[model samples]
Target: MHPRIRLELAKRWSEPHREHHDTDHLAEVVRAVDLLASSGMAFDIDTVNTAAWFHDAVYDVHRADNVERSATLAQRWLGPGEGDRIAQVVMATTDHVAATGDVESAVLCDADLSILGADTERYDRYAHAIRVENLHVPDAEYRRLRSRVLARYQARSELFATAAARELWEDQARENLARELTRLGRPVAV
Candidate 1:
């Protein structure tokens, strides 16, 4: 991906209404893709880059159709054939809820979880950002939701798909989830 294109995507992604899917989120995913690329995953870099820019470009947390909306936006932004590929990657992200998936989708999903494996300070900041982004929900409701999300991650076979991510991040992600669960007074997954 060109630096100029990345800048344009960053500008487009910098909307005030976006809570979690802002430029920082996109940047982090891009970094994850780079890490995966360096780890010899042979990812479709351009497709991943395009998908990262638009995955949450149309997010509506309450709307189940946001994935399709974002995919449509990706298609419009990237042009026909290339657009379809990017849309596929964007659509793959919805698999967490839809659970109908593919390898690239798995990679995207894992990359999204990469924040959990970040250095402690960055992980803490990411957690705080998520809480603030979701501050619209009442405290009790947020606690329950947060617990469910962390528990889901803890239950996964591996928090990430790529070998490098798994080796470098698996323990930290598990620890992050355990800490969050403990904070919410939920039983840690043994």
Candidate 2:
């Protein structure tokens, strides 16, 4: 990674309106990718780390095109081949679903979502941060939409696509989602 790119990314993530999608979240995803790579996981570490830095670069809580815009931003800094791959990884975070058979994409997605399995205190802080980011929405509406989003992950048979991620974080992620749903007055789907 170039120093210039790192500096640019830091600036983008430091935007004042960002609450959850700030530099801290970017660092967490990068750290998660590093941890996964250190554990002997076979994937392109550079691509995953690059994707992590640019994934939320264009975040806008009220905008639906953040993922697409983020991918486009990647193209400006990365070469065609690497940029395309990073774009795909960035887009994958939008749905937390990777392209079938794409290991790098799976790893990137898992790293981006690592927050879901964070311990109770950290998870609580993440939840609070997200709520702050979406403060424009009414409390009831926020709860409704947030519940749906969390339930979507909870209802999935597997929260993580990577084997290591599933083994390490699946149970905890499910527990966190379930507890959050309960607090939101949304019944956890069976």
Candidate 3:
């Protein structure tokens, strides 16, 4: 990665109000992608890494266009071919829905969502961290919105796109989501 791009990404993710979407989260995703690649999963590592670094580069709780803005930022910094690939990968994080046959995008999506399968303590912290990020919202409203978001993921037949990710994370991710939903006073899906 270019030093300038690294610096810019650092600056954006370092925003004081960000709790879960900070540089640490970016590093975690990068590490996850690297691990998957090292295990012989075939994908454009460079593009995946680039996308990981920029995926949450423009996070805003109130903004639905953060993914588009992040994609544009990637294009601006990385230029066409690679940038476009990175942008597509970043966009995949918007809904965590990679197109069929797009392994690279699937890997990127899996990497971004890896935290969902973390241990109970860590997952709890992640949930709290997100609440902190959206601190402006009332508790009840946040719970409702957060429940809806988790429900969307839970409703998916497959939570992780890549086989490796699915094998490793699917069950744990579903368990974690159910736990969270119960905590939020929402009924978990069967």
Model 2 residue 94 CA deviation (Å) reads 1.7
* 113-157: candidate 2 lDDT, tens digit per residue: 899999989999999999999999999999999999998898888
The local distance difference test score of model 3 is 0.90
Error of 1 at 177 (Å): 0.7
After superposition on all C-alphas, the RMSD of every candidate to the true structure, in Å, is 2.9, 1.1, 1.0
Q: lDDT per prediction?
A: 0.76, 0.90, 0.90
The ten-residue window of minimal lDDT in model 1 covers 95-104
* Better structure of 1 and 2 per TM-score: 2
The residue-level lDDT of candidate 2 at 173 comes to: 90
Q: In model 3, what lDDT does residue 72 have?
A: 94
Pairs with backbone N, CA or C atoms under 3 Å apart (clashes), candidate 1: none
Better of 1 and 3 by TM-score: 3
Q: TM-score of every model?
A: 0.85, 0.96, 0.96
Clashes per candidate (backbone, < 3 Å)? 0, 0, 0
